[model samples]
Target chain A: MTTAPLGQLPGQTRRGERILIGLAVGLTLLFIAAPLVFIFVRAFAQGWQVYAANILHPATLHAIWLTTITAIIVVPLNVGFGIAAAWAVAKHRFPGRGILVTLIEIPFSISPIIAGICYLLLYGRQGLLGPWLQANDIQVVFALPGIVLVTMFVTAPFVAREVLPLMQAQGSEQEQAAVTLGANGWQIFTRVTLPNIKWALLYGAVLCTARAVGEFGGVSVVSGNIRGQTNTLPLHVELLFNDLNAVGAFAAASTLTLIAVVALVIKAILEGRRQS
Target chain B: MTAAATHTGAPIRAKRVLPGFTLSLGTTLLYMTFIVLIPVITLILKGAEIGPERFWRIISSPRAVAAFQITLTAALIATAFNAIYGLLMAWVLVRYEFRGKRILDALMDVPFALPTAVAGLSLTALFSANGWFGPVLDAMGIQVVYTIWGIALAMAFTSVPFVVRTVQPVLEDMDPALEQAALTLGARPWAIFTRVVFPAILPAWLAGCTTAFARSLGEFGAIVFIAGNLPFRTEIAALLAYIRLEEFDYNGAAAIALVLLAFALVLLVVSNVLQAWASRHREASR
Candidate 1:
């Protein structure tokens, strides 16, 4: 299966297969790989000293820190909800199962900017909870809370989607077996379910982390892009780019690009394991 | 045995007294409500508060209409390109073996993993008058950056994986027997594909296109950089909503956002239906 199954198809001659492979590879390199390479090229276009300085700049550090903090918080919350949702949907039959699954996927289809707008409609100064929040002197939108909440919203489905399929495919047979063996619910989940899903859980976590760190549109609308404060890496890249610091922007971007690459590598390796 | 809990799905729910069902479902509903459902509810309410007439007026404003037109046009173009490119990638990846195929397969997800803002920045820089591909195209009188083409390119870039990923599994799982029968019947390769293989993968391809189109409609971060955000030109609906928010025109923003939300919801349902149809199609055919 790993090798070419050429000549299996009526139209797929050796030449045709080569042509398609060349086209896929060439177009991918041009359209996909080139931009990734360009990020580093522009980042170090001025050489290591400038790239190093840009990477070490106060703005860059703050952005990285903020993005890291956001991911650190969002990833775990997503994982918790992910596990819970997967348990609910994949392991048991329920009345509103279809609706819950649909609701879980809503954020994926909605624009992140619209998600921010949704929050603004609920929690902004002139929003649904505006007067109450004002009375309490609490700031949600245009702040760190807003950034974290929106990131959570945008990435909420990643972990659940990943783990649910695995759980559904594996089914609850093991858990049912544990129960027949007189294992309690907690014991069953911990001893049987968790062990089976650990890889998918990690896969989901990796995707969630990647998304939480890179979230921008919603964060931008809600963050107010305060330098040395609320700007995450993605926002900061925009800020630096707008400031005419293309080099610095790409320098900041290179970090995220590296994270993305690492995440993909991990995902690919995990996928290989699953297939094997 | 709780009769009510088991009433709807009587057979299965009766047997599995799973430990975490209530607690897990409760957590999922509560979290979804606070984080997603409630905010969305408020947005719909806000949109409703404007009344249909006002909402219509707001969205039909000349600039708003233009943004919708541009976004739709660009998203359509992006979806079309991805449809072809995705099918090609899936077909090649599944049918052919080549050096670096795995690497290329892995690379398909770069757009997914890469931050949209970075993609936008890199694309903008690369297509600007001085960046890598700019001059070569410029000499041919082709300009990409700050145009609808740029917007479509960015959208296509961000959504590249959707189609390939969706269609790949379907293609891989396709039964060889059907094609073999077609070949034994003296069908040409094109006929085999069109009559046999293509029917098998149609639902999945359509499902992928629906999602890619939905994604293109909502795309923001990646497009803003390359599109130049010119009013009545490249400004997408999402960006327009953001602009209204920035201007403190909450009513206007809410009105426009409601439209985009509607599009998303409809597309989500359509995609789900297509996914179901695809699986059923596979089961029946297999």
Candidate 2:
């Protein structure tokens, strides 16, 4: 049964439906766009020179540098793991597959703050691995490694979530065909499976990258928020805001917002293409 | 395969199988166990260490109890609001054609793109006493920033996309002819919606709301900035968990975390059941 029951209105009431649709569209746009507009207004209202200065500050530069480095490390790690997990879960019918799928999604449900605490419990000074790590002078918490780990934890499911369903829907026919044609596993994966999943992988990576750059709660607990050292862009934005430098905060935030907007535009374009 | 035979020069290597399924599944299980399960299990174990009486006392303290109530209430309010707004937004985007529609669609993802802290700060600035909306509301003797209302607003901003994204696909997939058939049969718009379109999309809508509610319950960064963080009045459970951690109260933190976890589990179970039932109903109707 085709379910396109269009709204029916008498000729006298047709105008009312248009008004209702207009109001719904208008309200949603206003709610979604207001904050973004507010940021730009605040940023520019204080003169362009102040905005430029704030954006070009050494600390701001450092925060962006740190965030970029973290993303570089995070995106690749997640992509590799996402591929592996997606490959296993989508193709293999192993015992505990259901449980594993649920476990993979636990990070999505658990708060990022709690994820930070988990890392602390596992590798903090008093944690289970703390003694061993301490003996080797390995600092996981309040360090780059800790930041990367938490980011990985939070973004683990992205690529897997993207690729799994695609793989499931497409099935193992291509791989089987390749196998019969004398292609080895690695060759099939690199040449066959990889090509099919490349777009989904890219989409997932874009999302993971955006999330990693904006990650705060988990990183906040582990980074110790040490300004000019461990503080990421998001943390830096908060730091500047707390220090009462609202202009600087807005400037830095606007830049991050710009990056995010660009990423989102790309995601939307890709998704639109995928839909078409 | 010939490629495998050629790649492995050694005859013995060609004859050997790599145990792909076994190796990959083993690695995946080991990774999940080490990364996700162990940490959650540790939290449960730590909570158990505090003993039942102590755990109950910690979680039942006036501050903790108040925080839970406020968090739940605000989350429910936020989720309910988003359910209506998100559904409308999704419906418009999927069904309508208008000027600036593309930009409007892109704006829906702004919440996802922007940092929670930044979103929180913007809202605080916009709604504080001397700020934009703050002055307007102040004239009416109504406060938003640092109140439960602020918390709910922050949550609604972040969660608007969840329901929209979830329901949009289902709505797009729905066949238009069904609605046309209902219209031809003299069903009113409202009747058609409730009887036909609603049932098809209700499952996705509920799933989206569940996700949005869970997200709002756990939300801290955005709410923290605008919530004023008043202990008994505006403090949320997740924020309380943070406070306990700050105070070096590990047991208390674990207790609060356990409570949040329990609620999340319950919601997940309910959502799963609803999804299953809805799918079965759809199949039977078909």
Candidate 3:
């Protein structure tokens, strides 16, 4: 099932297959690489001094900082929530388990922009919780808290999707054995379940972090694009672009492209290892 | 260890790391209700606030109707393109080994990682009248950017991975013996694929296509930058929704959103059914 089938063909057929495969692969690479290459070429063509100046600009620096802060807060919180949800869904078999599984995947179907609207409907001034929150002077929209909340909502499913399948496949045998041998619930989970799921959890975390960092639509709606304050890296790129600072826009975009490339590399490596 | 066994009155004490299934299930339901269901319900509720006549007016207005038509047409074209290309890419990756195979495989995920906004901008730059390929197309009098083709291009870029990712796994898990036996009986590669391989993977391919369509339908960040936001020409439904939001017409925004939500829900159900049917087929074949 895993072996390459083209190797079994006749020499001419094999050569033809190779050429076809080469063409397909070549086009795919060109399509994927063109934008990243264009950004780099455009960014550096003007010289390093211009690029450095843009990088050091306060607004640009703040955008990067705000994005990092959001990631720091959102990633761990989602990881915790994801683990809890996955633990419940994977190990349990009560009524509504199917519905819970379906519910966990709702974020996938819902647009990030809609996710922003959802938050607005819940926490906006005219929202269900708006009065209470406003009375307490808690600003959720056009604020950092709002930005993080929507981001969290958008990325909530990643870790759970990763952890759920692995947990279900592994089942409760090991955990049961540990419990029967005198380990308590917490100890069994810590000593057995956690260790087993560590790699998958890390993989999921990497994906979630990448998404949280790159997230723009949901965050944009709530962040208000307040320069140097609520702006994320993606928004910063847009801001620079809109400001007609083409050089700065490409520079920031290149930085994000680099992060995305790194994340892709990590994901590919992890997936490859799992396959082998 | 038998502490529960010694207790005659109590049902077998359930020893578990997490709470009982009922409690956990309840928690999951409550959380999803508060977070997902409520917001979605509110979106529809807001739309309903506009009386039926007004709701119909909002959705059927010239600009809004054009946006819907353009969005649907571009999504259909892009998804069709992806259905063919993605299948080829998946087949090549799963069935062949060549130099740079690993690199090619990794590149499939570029759209997913790259922010949609950046993708839209870069594609516009690449295909616009002044872009690298734009001048070449201009010689032949072809326009892309700020046109329907540009919208399709943006949609295609973001949607390519959906079909590829969905089909690749099914292709990988497919037993090679079936193909080998067919070939041994003197069947040609095309016949074997069309007769045997295609049928097996058809359900998954259809599912992937539906997902790609749904994704393209909702895509905004990328399309907005490239679509030129021209009413009745390039404006998409999602952009219309945003326009309504920007205009502070919450009723209109909610109405458009409801249309998108309904479309998405239908696609979701269809894909789920296709996936379920495909898995059942695999089991029966086994």
* lDDT top scorer: 1
Go through the candidates in order and give each one's DockQ: 0.65, 0.45, 0.46
Q: Flag the better candidate by TM-score, 1 or 2.
A: 1
- Over B184-214, each residue of candidate 2 has an lDDT whose tens digit, in order, gives 7877777977999898989889988998998
Question: Candidate 1's residue-wise lDDT over A1-276, tens digit each?
Answer: 223243475334567777778888889998999999999999999999999999999979989999998888899999999999999999888687888898898899999989999998888999999999999999998788899999999999999999999999998867866765678878988899998898899999999998899998999988988888989999999999999999999999999999999999999889888888
True contacts kept of each: 0.83, 0.47, 0.37
Question: Which of the CAPRI classes, incorrect, acceptable, medium or high, describes model 2?
Answer: acceptable
- Summarize candidate 3's per-residue lDDT along A161-270 as a digit string, tens digits: 99889999998778656755777666867898899888789889988988888887777776778887788888888788778787898888777778888888888888
Per-residue lDDT over B1-286 for candidate 3, one digit per residue giving the tens place of the 0 to 100 score: 3344234343443333343344545555666676577877877777667789999998999989899999999999999999988998998999888778888888888888888877877787777776677898888998888899889989999889999988898888887778777766777667888998899899889989998999898887788777788989999987777767667676777788888888888888898899898787677655
Ranking by TM-score: 1, 3, 2
Q: How many steric clashes does model 1 contain?
A: 0
lDDT of 2 at B171: 78
TM-score of chain A of 2: 0.92
Candidate 3 residues lying further than 4 Å off, grouped into runs, are A1-7, A10-12, B5-31
